[model samples]
Target: MTTERREPDRNADERTMLEGWLDYHRCTLARKCEGLTDEQVRTASVEPSVLSLMGLVRHMAEVERAWFRRVLVDDDAGWIYCSEADPDGEFRLTDADTWQEAQATWQAEIDIARRNAAGFALGDLSRGRSGSGGEPFSLRWIYTHMIEEYARHNGHADLIRERLDGATGD
Candidate 1:
């Protein structure tokens, strides 16, 4: 499946530019996983590294939930595929985990994230703290952080995809 990733408007406002770049990175990730089998997506990047395409998707879902629902919206909604007992659980695939399910969950989180972000201005501070006992973060900070997070992970996705099938490029 081809992902319709658009370039950020060069002349757009800060908010629009940020949102566009974030969405572009998001689609880049999805495009990286296109045409892969479930088994392929589940395949680890390399020895001693548990990272996989599907794992990235799952991890991003948790990130979206944490920043948007838990932080921005200040909702009590918790991690979708992780827990305090297994903080990195999303990166560890189970036999039952499928790409379809992971993609659906990730898309759902993205939807919630968009809605939550829309309610706040870029300069608005979050109701929730940054981390355990940390200070509250502004929407602007969250946006910048999220874009950076996705950009870094998308780099990993590129390598994972190329390793899996010689496919490359955003």
Candidate 2:
């Protein structure tokens, strides 16, 4: 099978530093979903879990939109995957429709996330509206949270991808 390759990094800075870390986990997760057929992407290797690679892609799409667009940007376009009727539905199997559709959604989310992040300054870290009205958090906290979330999922993706195929590491 053909493996997709990533380019080498050139230089480093505050922006690149954050992006490098983000890209590391992002590409790792993307690699986990690579080299699989559409059927494989949709297949639930873990029975009764609905946790397919396609599903993860879709879920992360919603996650990026919700966190960066809705929450951080104050767009108020509403949560992508969560609502009163379907709370925690982000992980649920909805309608990724097809492999291409899922990938497009994921790409869109990533693009928007990159754009949103670019608008911020490196040292700028402040909170906006609180969902619970309990307390406030810094933008730095949000960035760190996003990184942590991706890192955790990348680990899971590594194991899942390994089970799906013998592929490992970049």
Candidate 3:
């Protein structure tokens, strides 16, 4: 079980502060799934929704790969989990999907993302394509979007955990 040890500085520069807070949220998400069984991680929040700890982890891996490898690094390996054939595959957890593998994959993506974004400044533009042919973005935007993505999913994790075993936290 992973424990929470993320502590962000109250004061820092833009990059430092954003990275600290983003790491805090990342650790927070990992903490939300601590000590859970494979089946437990796959348990959906409600009957109608596809929300689960495993699904969230998988989705984050997809996000990390897309933003870092495809968008940031200009690679073509897009959508790690979902696809046009199975767009919701990340949330489609089965007994074959182990938590150990999920954690490792997510961690690997996180590492790649960190490395890919390391060379760029906050104001650097993205080289990825867009609807209008191509539109650039700041590294700051990527960092902030990552924070928001984790924050949203972490909230879902909180609800799912609470529903699973009455566990709760900030």
Candidate 4:
């Protein structure tokens, strides 16, 4: 992949720090899919689990769209994949899903997420549901959550990638 993952600076402001870390995790996920074919990426490493590198990409795209477009932006932008009919569609990758298209959509959602967050301050309240009282969530909270989400999925990607070709690293 062309994108290079960078480390977050310690001396940066909170917003920059959060964004940097989030970006780092995002790149980590992308790195796991680098140099892999569509069929290889579609292979599930663990039995009884639909986990795969491409599935993770698709899932992250849905996450970005949900949090940034529908929640953060307070727009009624519909879901990306998961729905009543196919609740786990994001993780259900087949030979039909080319790596290029999945990667493009994921990257695009990340860009949109950045744009949505740019228009708000860290403390800015999102219309999305909060932890309690049905209150709005903060941009900072959303950023932190997104970072955690990527970190967890990146771990899964690591296992799947290693099993796929014996390749491993951050």
Highest lDDT scorer: 1
Report how far residue 131 has shifted in candidate 1, in Å: 4.6
C-alpha local distance difference test of each model? 0.92, 0.70, 0.84, 0.88
1-170: candidate 2 lDDT, tens digit per residue: 44343443667665666677776667767778877898777777587776777777777787777777776676665665568997656556545467787778778888887887778775554334556765545556667777798888777676667778767765
For model 4, how many clashes? 0
lDDT of 1 by residue, 77-146 (tens): 9778899999999999999888999999999999989999999999998986466668788888899999
Give the TM-scores of the predictions, in the order they appear. Answer: 0.96, 0.80, 0.93, 0.94
Worst 10 residues of 4 by lDDT: 127-136
Q: Give the residue spans of candidate 2 off by over 4 A.
A: 1-11, 94-96, 125-128, 131-136
Evaluate model 4: give its TM-score.
0.94
Predictions: Cα RMSD each: 1.1, 3.1, 1.6, 1.4
Worst 10 residues of 2 by lDDT: 1-10
lDDT of 4 by residue, 87-165 (tens): 8899987657788888899999999999989999999999764556777888998999999999999999999999999
TM-score of 1: 0.96
Each candidate structure's count of clashing pairs: 0, 0, 0, 0
Local error of candidate 4 at 140, Å?
A: 0.3
Question: Model 1 misses residue 106 by how many Å?
Answer: 0.3
**Position 131, candidate 2: lDDT:** 61
Tell me how candidate 4 scores on lDDT.
0.88
**Judged by TM-score relative to the true structure, which candidate is superior, 2 or 4?**
4
